[model samples]
Target: MGSVEIIFHGAAGTVTGSCFEVRANNKTVLIDCGMFQGTRSLEALNHEQLPFDPKAISAVILTHAHLDHSGRLPYLTAQGCHAQIWMTAPTADIIEPLLLDSAKLQAADAARRNRRPDRMALPPFIPLYTGDDVTSCIGQIKETCYGAWNELGNDDGFRLWDAQHIVGSASVELKLADQRILFSGDIGGGSAIQCADVPLGGYDQIICETTYGDRTREPVLISDRREQLAQYIEEALGKNGNVLIPAFAVERTQIVLEDLVALFESKRLKPFNVFVDSPLAERVTRTTQRHRLTGYDLFSVPNIRFTHDVEESKQINSMSGVIIIAGSGMCQGGRIRHHLLHNLPNARARVLLVGYQVAGTLGAVLRDGARNVRISGHDVPVRADVKIIDSYSVHADRPALMQWIKDRGPVSGSVFLVHGEQHALSVFAQDIRKAGLAPHVVVPMLGESWSVSANHAAKRICPAREDLQVRIAPRDWTASLAALKSGLADRLRALPSDAARERVLASMTRALEDAESIRTIT
Candidate 1:
């Protein structure tokens, strides 16, 4: 019997980048080719050499259109990977605008950085992938449907099941020889809309995402979430301030629109200027409307303004008592930054966070209650009311994740966790073990590989790379601590007193000595 080997390339430890490779006989397949995001250290991995030759990949199965899952397609194409990309029809439609917008953002960021005259001379800035690369990647896409088996060459095949994370998200079932492996791309158990059904009791091995594995979310009723949103809008509008929502262009935007519409239709919210600011989000919203016509709507709201031109987007800043929904969900970039710049200092303004914010992202900084945050080289005061509603997230929580696994019956082979932080993975792994849901549970590190046979036996043939050990290491608390210390030192140095300088030095020495003591004990 032939053997099937699966490799964890990214998203094995951290939550952002996601890539997995499966090989059987002489053919190879890739599950996802997402880009690294969040911290600069992690984002640098996007420019690092890919672990395997992309050209050798025979095909790729995309689970959804999220950047964290499909952002690197253009980069892969640029690197000479000519694999046939497969996804649902909606994913195909949504990814087109998302990728092109990503390219534009990258180019814009590079241009902005190079314009600083005080900057030291460096190599010319280049985007990760150009517009042509995105076109090339789109040309290779082949659409598929839910519940249909498609061949992956060499007698291995896969079936896509709706993952319910987004409009076209899916979970994959790969059949190799006598063994069946299921990949849970991203599970959306607590979403506002109805998620696709979860398949049960058919696979030998399962790879799952644990984005919310460690935390149990409060069961948020959709009506309650909508009511809360209405209250926030009313409060902001009463002060003649605008309400800004930095949302994902995909499902998040659609769902929020639906909620807003429901509130308006129910007469719970007053009629106001609702602007869909991101051009990409506008296109996505249109696509979602078409899908909704086919009985796949979250909630449809009418009388919203869709702004695409730069002048129109700029005009939004001058408007009052408006509700604006824009992209760059984490506030790392995009039009959301411009809105934040204009509204953050306005005490009457409200910023509603409706998605998961990665650590080190501007969204996280705001969510963590930073009194002052740097934006476009300016320190913006956090005067606006910031509100976060947990129900808006698309990922499954810990209880839902565990129940999903349990409902899938017993896995004869093993369970592997990905797409989560170290703490979430650790907690979920323990939960799985304590529940005895699988014979073996592995929290894979990046570059790790496992070989599985038809008889349900699996062996680890390769360990993770030592150089990329940080990819699997526990969340870098040291980095955060160092940043805090550095910021404090800078503030102390600006105190214009020798006593302040001495205090900085004294604090630094104490921290270093404590670190040394911990290191010695470890």
Candidate 2:
């Protein structure tokens, strides 16, 4: 058995920006390189040099495509670290657009500040990464299937499972000799139709998210959220004040669009123009459509006027009462901030938030009913009514999280609670210990190491199968087709009807093992 060291560089106390490094002797694999997006004091942390030399890192694994989980890659690659990014196919498709768009915005801001009217009087805050950086980062993708054990770098291997948070999201299980660690990037309950079937697995150690770990949100009935949004929009439309929604360009934007379209379809709303004002969101919608070719969609809403250029977006804002969905979901930075400045001072307008608003964010302050918020170095009075639809949060609640853990059986190693606020982690830690685990709880601080004692380490070891881990299938009879089915569903889902007719038909044969009940972590 080998010893491994881990560091909790980000997402330790506050949420947003998740990064961790696992070191096994000289080899290290970093999981998730998300950039911090919040207050300048905190976001400045990303601008500081990486804690460890990026050059020493061997490979990187992505939990999902959320900016908090994968945002910092362009900076990492630009600085050093030329390793491949391992993730499921859906993750690969989404990351390209996200990274590229993020980089473009960063470059634009840098240019704008240089030419600002107050350039002589004000100091500049440069963007963390550039478009050139994203171009390089997107080329390093290596897609992996779920539920498969495979070697990584020189001395490590990991098994991926369906996390169901996002299209390609997975809970990663890493093996380094006798030690293994499981990372829960962000988990999704079966609440949304797009989430894949949750998979059950074994792990020696587990690191999970506590975004909704503190409270069991009473199951948010879909009807309630729809009504909340409809009521807000209906009122705003009646006043003819613009409704500015700061939406994440990924699943959040798509779901909101879906809800709006549903309202339109049901004749519950008027024929007002809806503008999706993020270029990235437009591409992400295409990615969503690509997934639909396989018959899976997380609320496919159609008919949006995608506005990319600044002038076009400005024009939409100038023309009163248009519903605008813009990016940088939490309102930290982006064109959404510009749109907010105009609509927020108007009593007829509304600012709608349908996602988690982190602390130190304009969205959070607004959600918490702040009368005024500072944006772009200016404090603006809040005249527009702000509405928060917390039910629409993509992160599963406490009950859902608990069910997912229960379904995974007795994970016999150290379980670390992460990707949540300190309060959330504290409460969940006690509950985890109650589940009868060996050294059940670990809340790792930045750069903490967990090494195994030779006396306590397990002796069982599997021989390495190098090339097959990356190939179509491993040359082993013990591995079942059912495991492969869940791992490569996207590939299978995209197979031609005639070409994969028999192979696809064979996958429908469920084994007795499939009868195992899924546990929810709510």
Against the true structure, candidate 2 has what lDDT?
0.73
lDDT of 1 by residue, 65-137 (tens): 9998999999998898998999999999999999999999999988876776634487766789999999999
lDDT tens string, model 2, 237-323? 888888888999888888787777777778887767889888888889889778645322433435468887889988986687679
> Which candidate tops TM-score?
1
TM-score for each of the candidates: 0.89, 0.81
For all candidates in order, the CA lDDT equals 0.84, 0.73
Q: CA shift at 332, candidate 2, in angstroms? A: 1.0
Q: Residue 16 error for model 1, in Å? A: 1.4
| Ten residues in sequence with the least summed lDDT for candidate 2 | 469-478
Q: Please give the TM-score that candidate 1 achieves against the real structure.
A: 0.89
